[model samples]
Target: MTKSDTITWIRLSAVRLPLPVPVSDAKVLTGRQRPMTEVALLFADIATAEGHRGIGLTYSKRAGGPGQFAHARELAPALLGEDPSDIGRIWTKLVWAGASVGRSGLATQAVAAYDIALWDLKARRAGLPLAKLLGAHRDSVRCYNTSGGFLHAPVGELVENASAAVARGIGGVKIKVGHPDPREDLRRLTAVRERLGDGVPLMVDANQQWDRPTARRMGRALEEFGLVWIEEPLDAYDAAGHAELAAALDTPVATGEMLASVAEHRELMRLGAADVLQPDAPRIGGITPFLQLAALADLDHLQLAPHFAMEIHLHLAAAYPAEPWVEHFDWLEPLFEERLSIEDGRMLVPGRPGLGITLSEQAHAWTTEVFEAGVAP
Candidate 1:
């Protein structure tokens, strides 16, 4: 690649969007009716001298927008004049540069923005879609709907949501559990199971609401429902507890969404903490480390189901040798110009160069702040 392909300028911005419907899980059961909002996104756009630009983003539930933007600003100088395709070198450099502060949380989230943009840039430069660029194992992957089944909704509403998702061709559905009364959780699960029947896959997320004993007791009780997996039955860092719960229950234990590094995931695997691994690209330092973690999961023969951001995870999931599940979330749909295509529970991977989507006019309008660095072309 020519010098024109080198990074010339970097732009960072924060976008705050109000959720059309506030979502509450078991962890936030008290705030059920309140209309919660999310900062939604912190975006990065890397412009190369060749004039091609790649866009990337990380998200926050309701905060961390300012911190992510500030970290990106601090990291941008290290990337200016560097080759956009040198993703590994750049990722390492950024990680070490911010090591004094920490390698996880906001810092890694910031690194994700740049690293994702670089992969997008590289894929676009090659004129291949990200999945194809990464050597896709398949062009489409199965999906499950998780947006509708929140703890705040009535039991009838939960059943309706899962039914509607199945009618729309989604193969699976998940609902929030972890109420103070385990019987209440069981009641909701029973209703959903009756509605969806035995054919449709059902899963539940506890959202780390239990200790080891509770997790073990509840996991065994819920086994009768034939759940696809029990997600976050305990705190994400509780490796020994997770392993114990996994061994004691018939249901597969799944976690890793909140984790921040490959080393953390390595520890989880080493401890046999989970039967299924759910890594998020942005949270684990973007696509580079995600690939590393996926490889590790493959060697261990664990199931792969990445956390959120289906638009990005769809491509990564398709790269997995075994069939993987991508989560369907419409929360960020307003920020993008194109919507993903789904049929019969599988989403089609975009074949266009890079991630194959552009930020919408609404995304620009929602921008709360912007930061820029590097020389103009």
Candidate 2:
């Protein structure tokens, strides 16, 4: 049999990539202190019998490292001797295999790594970039900066960060809201708007800190600033609350970053929970289900602005029929050798095959543990 016809082996590693500058956000769901020092990245590499290799990765913010890694180990043996190109079948198989303890969270994240690796292999075989392989809708997509606008930073520092991004030609900027005092949130947003001027698009993420009443009140109060959208103003599962908030406010409501599956996104859309969808590729079971979520959002007339990991989202956003926005967060740059190009407020889609990323030597040095899984006899 040809080497490319069957899967040979899978390699997984858990790397502790430290943040250059610790980040803090207002909505502390984990009951932890501000400024998390690092994040755990679970990396997967799949090798074909034909000598082709593809890479995939998923991450956890604080805990769950062992769970995600174990899930990868558990699912790796299922792909032995299977056709790598049969992504749909492989994905379904993995989902059901782990159905007892899967379908969301760590299990789906493990599935994402495998699904993404399959797509990378498929794209490489086709000699086409993933975006083109998926059918390109545009050559580039608009982007906004989110890395610089954290909740713990001083207002002046936030202004400076936004200014730097704007000067670099980023079309928009977003800041964290949901401070304990509503007036503090207002003060920060007002300062940023004044610094950025009226024409530049601005956004705020509450990180699901407020109740429906608070979201309504704050959304109405901030309407005068002319935001691009208000993100995660209520809990992710509070579909009814989100819909009511969207109805009451002029600012478009956006969420779904924390959702683990397309079914959750469907519920959000069916309830009119948001006008914009912010699906994350890894969080939604890789590009396979991400495309599913994107199509659903498009059919429902919702705008697309995928949540972080710009390397993957850039391609996905470029393929969206509507001009979708990609969030910019550079904390993960240390893990990759190559970076995306931004020109005149838009991110250019890479022409490289697959996801167009390579793990850096730094990442290798930072890895804490590694695991290998082989095909079943």
Candidate 3:
């Protein structure tokens, strides 16, 4: 491939991948939603005239798969002959191509698939891992587990899950909080804490279920547990409340995973609302906006613990200036042929070029729809 090489084709696939089991969280306990049994993944594959290829993915939990697929299909034609190496430029072009619906949320989410593909393509073109391409700060990151600690699990299950995670080399454990009965929430926390012991890192997430007074009260109670962080105790958009809570609490406040734009995250930084910023690359328009946000967060001296998509976040987290954390979820494991190595409580960076992942046969078997657009050589 040369500078003259251009994108030849782009393929998009929408797969309705079923979860092995339904998982519930604070949202379910609050009756705002039901257990989630499946996820919708939008995968973008970009190929160039020189036979170079790259893959990227974005996903929706309950809804927006069709919307994202429709939006992605609508924008694929615009990249038929553009240089995939021109990632930032292409990101701007795609954002404007779908400007009517706005740049955040679903529109940018759709663009995220393509944006990430370009980044992956560029890294592969260099024969380097994305982290190395971006100048990595660390070769491994501290890892934690959330899949085993949902609110639906029984106390014994929670302990077992935490034990299993610890035995598997996960450095920290986070469980769902914000139960209908605050006592029950505390009980769960205490049980998990007692089981994990004091030295281990422990965290809890309210999943945006607590109001101001409740958040404050619970934040006060949570102080005794020596939590590494308390996450999303208020609504995702309540920057002011979070700032106030951060000022009042001893535990670090972490949020921003649910936020969908750089502008929204800037508000968090402006107010110093959070101690740890948990940005999801796919959720906020892929690596393009994620990097933009990371740069801003770096300037503020914020801790990075990006939420979900470990395969993608691992590389991005590695590139972060501060020592960052990456989440570990086994749900997406079936979609990729390779597995990440967890050793000594850290997830090691793979030496494979690009994102270092290849889709599994099962991933294709679950695909509900696929489409192609662009000029293939």
lDDT of 3 by residue, 128-206 (tens): 9999999999999999999999988999999999999999998999999989999999999899898889988998999
lDDT of 1 by residue, 143-200 (tens): 8888888887889999998999899888799999998788899999999998888988
Write the residue-wise lDDT of candidate 2 on 115-180 in tens digits: 888888888888888899999899899999999988878998999999999999898999999888
- Against the reference, the lDDT scores of all candidates come to 0.88, 0.88, 0.94
Clashing pairs in 1: 4-50
| Winner by TM-score between candidate 3 and candidate 2 | 3
Candidate 2 yields a Cα-based lDDT of: 0.88
Q: What are the per-model numbers of colliding residue pairs?
A: 1, 3, 0
**Candidate 1 residue 177 C-alpha distance from true site, Å:** 0.4
Top lDDT prediction, candidate number:
3
Off by over 4 Å in 2: 1-4, 29-34, 375-377
Model 2: lowest-lDDT 10 consecutive positions? 26-35
Which sequence of candidate numbers ranks them by lDDT, best first?
A: 3, 2, 1
**Which residue pairs in model 2 clash with each other?**
3-49, 3-50, 4-50
Query: In terms of lDDT, which candidate is stronger, 2 or 3?
Result: 3
